[model samples]
Target: MGPESAGSAQRSHVDRLYHLPMITPQGGRRSAMVPDVEVDFGAGPTTVPSTMRYVDLTGNGRIRVPAQGAVDWSQLNKLPECITVEWSGADRGVVEAVAARQIRFLYWHDASGTVDLTGTGVTDVRLDGIGLRSVRLPESARVLLLREPPESLEVDAPESGHRMDLRLFSRGPDIRIPGGLSRVSELWLKVAGTVSASVLTGLTDLEELRVSFDDPPGVFADAQDLQAHRGLRTLQLDDAYDWDPGNLPELPSLRGLEINGTRRATATVVKARFKATDVRISIHGAKSEAWLAAHMSNPFRDWVEDSKPFGAAACEAYTRARSAIEALAPTASDRMAVAEHALRGLIAALNAIDAEYQLIDTLRREQAGEVFFELAAQAEVPVDQARRWFADRDF
Candidate 1:
């Protein structure tokens, strides 16, 4: 039959059985059938019983369903293992159906209102859009990404060996990470509103953390709580306004720390606090002597250490360039002259090295360019002027 005629027949079939009520797992009643639906089980669309009309099985035990109207999903003979639902409004039956079947992975998009999966066995969930009033995930969840901030959120502690990597974009003051979720190992929070770092109290196992804010008071409220994560190895804090770094404890495990767009005092304090440690610190927006010294100590340390036997000349050139930049005077004009001469010398040295070793490939050239610009930045050369500084280079 043609598509229109088949659709009409399907509607007629569902209309005849629309009066039948299906009992949900919660003991509530809802319509047994939805009309004019096709199930695509990976291969192609196929006709299914009217009672299973709204659900489209897309193979590998994954199903796509709509949340626009009331339909009793519990009536299905078999439920898919993974489900993606585009929700328009609150549907307690949908949540109950997922909970009843223990859906493993759920991608709920364009949803609003509250959804509490407190007792479900869902392991992976990705939620998007705004207007979420509250959400509660079960302890079984291991991977979660919330694209919009919900007003209230609660997540149970994740099971061991199933560490969760959570990324949250939050702008609501009410949103806070519960201490119970201590097993979160990697977290990224991009905030526009205030969020307390007290949330990090019990996340002792966190190895990497990144926090960025949108405006003043950009830092977390009680950022000192970060010290609790003794295992944290990498941290990036951006747009930190008036943050006091003195309270930040020394993290023995920290190998890399990047602080960008912070106040001068905070940057200086961070430089002082982490200098003696072997941590690689990258601070942006501050041209203080400390920042320059920390970054310039050896910009080419890795390259020099890993250089091949044939690349001795290139390594020496890199070392010489670094030395010249480090000795630059504090004045901008003196810095410009010293940096330009050092860059020219490095270029000449690289040209001679490439002539003999053929080492200046596209990758090497890009790497050299990055190092050059970083040196320029360290010299306090304006970026536009720095670009022109390299205009005459031959290498």
Candidate 2:
């Protein structure tokens, strides 16, 4: 037989069941002996062609894969491991800035009532003034900073890589560092909030730090009183963290120092003797704040007991909401709805809070208008008081 005849005869029993790559054009002929380019083993042993061979296989052994006309499973095999996944558990989010080796820095704006950022892989988050309920950074994260109040920004060390800077943006000097993160490989820590007790338990290995106190009470007076930063060689005390300049210390190993007293520390005795090292002491409170720091009231008196970890704005909002509700008349209905809606489902729990504002916040996010109307319609309370209470709110 000729080559064409042999080819046609061998493809007589070729079937499309098992594997079908492409049907042969010759198989369209009148003779049943025509060959088929695409063929499988379903046609029995007689369908075996002399061409294309299969990978090593024998007996009942089977490996379901995408090869030799099988379905492709490469995508499934390429998925990253579960450990590299970040789960931002909370609903409301403000993923202001996100940077990763796998993707470009994703800067997101928050306009939606509820922001969801559960898909950011192995999150390395950095944000400021974002109104998020919470954030969870993966263990693969290098640097996970919650510059804004993130309610609770949980960082599982190995998930992120924050070698450059980790800042907690607060208008004051107070912050909470996770106790779990025993060692911070980061080089600089500029906290814009209060540095409460044990909050620095995680920064045993930081190289440089500049912490601001939300409460400029000057209680953190002595640097020696601070939980020592073993690797710390430089320090910066903003007006929030400064006490009396005399109380400040200049370490022998200190390579750089910035004692930003501005004007707030001038009255306190916040002296810095950076005689031996390369320390830069900049007084940045009154003069440094050459411009006055905006006088903003504290927000948290109930939601986050000064001891708790959460966002300052969250507390501030709650505080404002409660104050407004107190000044409001009980008849306000629309205002109540706005507050409750803002709470979504936390209205009841918030109401249970001793600080009436927590519950009022639920109302604020819901129908705060109701509260205002009620207050306005009331004849008993002074109307001017209610007006001042809601002066800063969006209504």
Candidate 3:
């Protein structure tokens, strides 16, 4: 047996220890450093004067570029740059300090505008970031930012050909913003830490996507599976126990996916396959029935649900405990005194049990069946033996 096979029996540990690509600083530089290209930026260009260099103009921040004649932030490099300016605060009369970091610009192809945002010449403006809320281009129209807790940067513009990169500080990972993104192909999300979004619903043509989050400050969902990315060929979802991502992308053409986290991505059931593999994948949630079928080479594999038995058991226990406590309600008797004491005890115990299960989910991977394994581990028991597990699952 090779190193992969020899490690099979210990896959439970290996499954938790997934392998992901190490992002280099140079990789991040692409998104950070503003390109030095010289655009003719004709007379009408929303251009930046030579004096608009990076400066501590604000006297309090790292870098600031004050727009000269209607600042065109679209010319910025594909990275996180803080646009330090001022805006109206909640109290309209108050002058609020505004810093649009992780801003994005999208080519407004629909209703075109003029050189300025007044009529029909300035539609050339393009900004698209998750943290972007209301940025009126020309003056303060180009940059966007998440509401609170700063994030690094994430640009998912697959068509832009921009690499999956960003300038991340030690504490980075999430950017909250508006939903419904179907037109703009360039996607950027800052799940810098855990203060972020759960599902990226709009990018349908995406062939590959990589998400990085604080392993513990993860986001959870009600039911949407991420693998729903219709034409995705690659996926990388990593996080900690706190990261509660719902479903894995249910992609059929997925050639590879690299994942890391505490909870099993609930959406692992969509039938999918890949052209090949590069970075190893580590799955822990309810892996899709179609995935095993492809891996085992037995397209007819009957798969089992990989829900955490511990979680279910705890849930059932809580239900029973609640019913029992409710039964002792002093409704039909004059035992109101004991009822109060009993009810408190029941509530406390139920809460304690719930906490216990949550800890288990954090400390280790949810237990799965024998045939199942994380994508990261190498095949050991001949690809055929694994295929058999899928066939016998139904019976």
Local distance difference test values of all predictions, in order: 0.59, 0.38, 0.32
What TM-score, computed on C-alpha atoms, does each candidate reach? 0.44, 0.38, 0.30
Tens-digit lDDT track of model 3 for 158-189: 23222222212123333432332233322334
Instruction: Please give the lDDT score at residue 52 for candidate 2.
Output: 18
User: Tens digit of lDDT per residue, candidate 1, span 1-395?
Assistant: 11233323433433332211212122234356534345542344444434432232222123434334345465343433223333334554656767777466666665576667767887766676566655677777766767665445454444631367777766665556633456778787777645677766656569988786644456567767777778889887755655567667767788998775555667777888777778999875443445334332333322322234323566578778878888987865666777878887787777776666554543356657877787778777787787776665554
CA RMSD of each candidate after superposition: 20.4, 24.5, 19.6
Give the candidate number with the greatest lDDT: 1
Model 2's lDDT to the true fold?
0.38
The TM-score leader among the candidates is 1
**What digit string (tens of lDDT, one per residue) describes model 2 on residues 248-321?**
44345556655433354463343334444365444432432322332223323222211223223444444454
Rank order (by lDDT, best first):
1, 2, 3
Question: Which of 1 and 2 is the better model by lDDT?
Answer: 1
Q: After superposition, how far is residue 333 of candidate 2 from its true place, in Å?
A: 13
Clashes of 3: 52
